[model samples]
Target: MAPIRTFIAAPSNLGLKPPAPGVAPGVRHLPEHLQQFSFASRAGAVQTIYLEPPTYHGDIDPETRMRNADAIRGYSIVLAEQVQDTVRAGRQAIVLGGDCSILLGCMLGLRSQGNYGLFFLDGHTDYMWPEHSATGGVAGMDLALVTGNGHEKLTDIHHCRPYVPEQQVFCCGNRVPDESYVQLIRQSQINYYDLDALRRFGLPATAVQFLQLVETRGLDGFWVHLDVDVLHNDLMPCVDSPQPGGLSYAELRSVLLPLLSAPACKGIDITILDPTLDPDGRYASVFVDHLTGILQDAATAVL
Candidate 1:
């Protein structure tokens, strides 16, 4: 079988916590965790180039939470370079993240290539506005920043306004959106499906519908931003903010495999899994195996 290049990078440095010296609180030894699993061998994937930058910069300035986005953007540029090179080489990217905030860099890197949609699969909507983001938690306003609805620092990266446009983006599997943000969601043009809506449509139907939309819009391709918190709290409680209901591991696997296998899915970012919470490393192992399984399955199809 031909080698399936997976350009993996770690950008787990910009969350809600204060800056530390190493991996920070929520993300510690992620790349090492995956390395031990030997998942690349199991999945028939070649991690051509793994970019793991040691950073401890998730803190938002207490006095400048809302204004700190530019600072974070500067930090993101480091990882963005790795992401850009990986994609430009025509390889699929598998980003092992520190937090959902790393998403800004990944999308920015892809935007440099051409227009691509975003598949935001998370437990929370992460659609908070800047004025509402006094705490300066980039993870909370992830979707908002990408849509050019937040402060200029994050929105105008490389002058790529609205890094991922609302029209080409589809957010699914989010069960929680702060009460105040619901109205904003309703007003946006981006196609969003909450957990309830996904359940009603069913995962298979939802996957099919999403792919159709990608095709209909004629987007260059699409990138996936996966916050493992989207999994059931009982199953994946290692994330920062735990939500109650989510897709069971099996359900997410079934849904995600199809999407990843699709030709237009250029890359993916997996975030929000904290090893400190899973002292035994069981969760990280399972998560790695699950993702690798999907890639192996996709590789098998072509083989």
Candidate 2:
């Protein structure tokens, strides 16, 4: 097989979690998480870029329980530049994120390429508005912001609001969503599939549905977002917010392997897993093996 054009981006975790109650997340350890992921030797990756985060990572203001929007914007600017370079070079950008908040930067990068879609593989809806978000962590509101539902600082970054249109975006593997999110999605076109539905219909059917959307929409390509919290707590529990039920490694591979192989699947970002929680590297290794295995297979299939 020929070389798979993959650029691995490692960003800081300052953009990790929201200030939800009892959610003292450690997203800052993402660099460590990337270091331990032995994928370069196995996944056939070509290049890796270490994007630097600003000094003011986590919030200093406890009242807001979040960093200033200016800081968030700063980090995204740098992150976006990196992603843009990766896309412009016609390579796949595998962004190892600071948090889901950096998803904004990823979409902005893809927008530079063309009209792209998103396959949000996460546990939570992440569709809350800033006012409704209890803890001001942008992670909680990144999806809402990107979809043009929140404040301008994030939504209008690079003046690319509604980063991916609702019709082209799909939020799958969801196990948790607040009432507000439920109501919003009910009236919207964003495709959503909860864990129960995924289990019942299975990944093969789900992948076909996703591909059909791409074909019908005539999308330029699609980007994927994998928040590790989507994995079951027992199999992978080092994330900032650990929900009880989720997809196991085998289950995730079943869904991911097919999606990654699609030519229209342009890029991907993996987020929410924290290395600090896993002292023994047990969960971290699981994350790497599944990701690399699927990536390798995808590259091989295309070759």
* Candidate 1 C-alpha error for residue 121, in Å: 0.4
lDDT of 1 by residue, 1-303 (tens): 433567565745455555345445656456566667885566554664555554555545544355245556775676677778877777777777767778888888888888888888999888886567655678778888888886677878878887888988778888765666566776898888888888888886777777888888787788888998999998888878787879988888777877787877777888878777887888878888788887777655541
Off by over 4 Å in 2: 1-3, 16-25, 60-66, 177-181
Q: lDDT values of the candidates?
A: 0.75, 0.74
The most accurate candidate by TM-score is 2
Model 1 misplaced regions, further than 4 Å: 1-3, 18-23, 48-64, 67-71
Q: Taking the tens digit of each residue's C-alpha lDDT, what string does model 2 give over 1-303?
A: 433556555555555443454454566667556667765556666777777666544563443345556777777777777777877777777777668888888887777677888888889878776566665777877777777776677778878877888888888887875555567665778887878877888876787788888888888888889998999999888877788888888888888887888877777888877766788888788678878888888876761
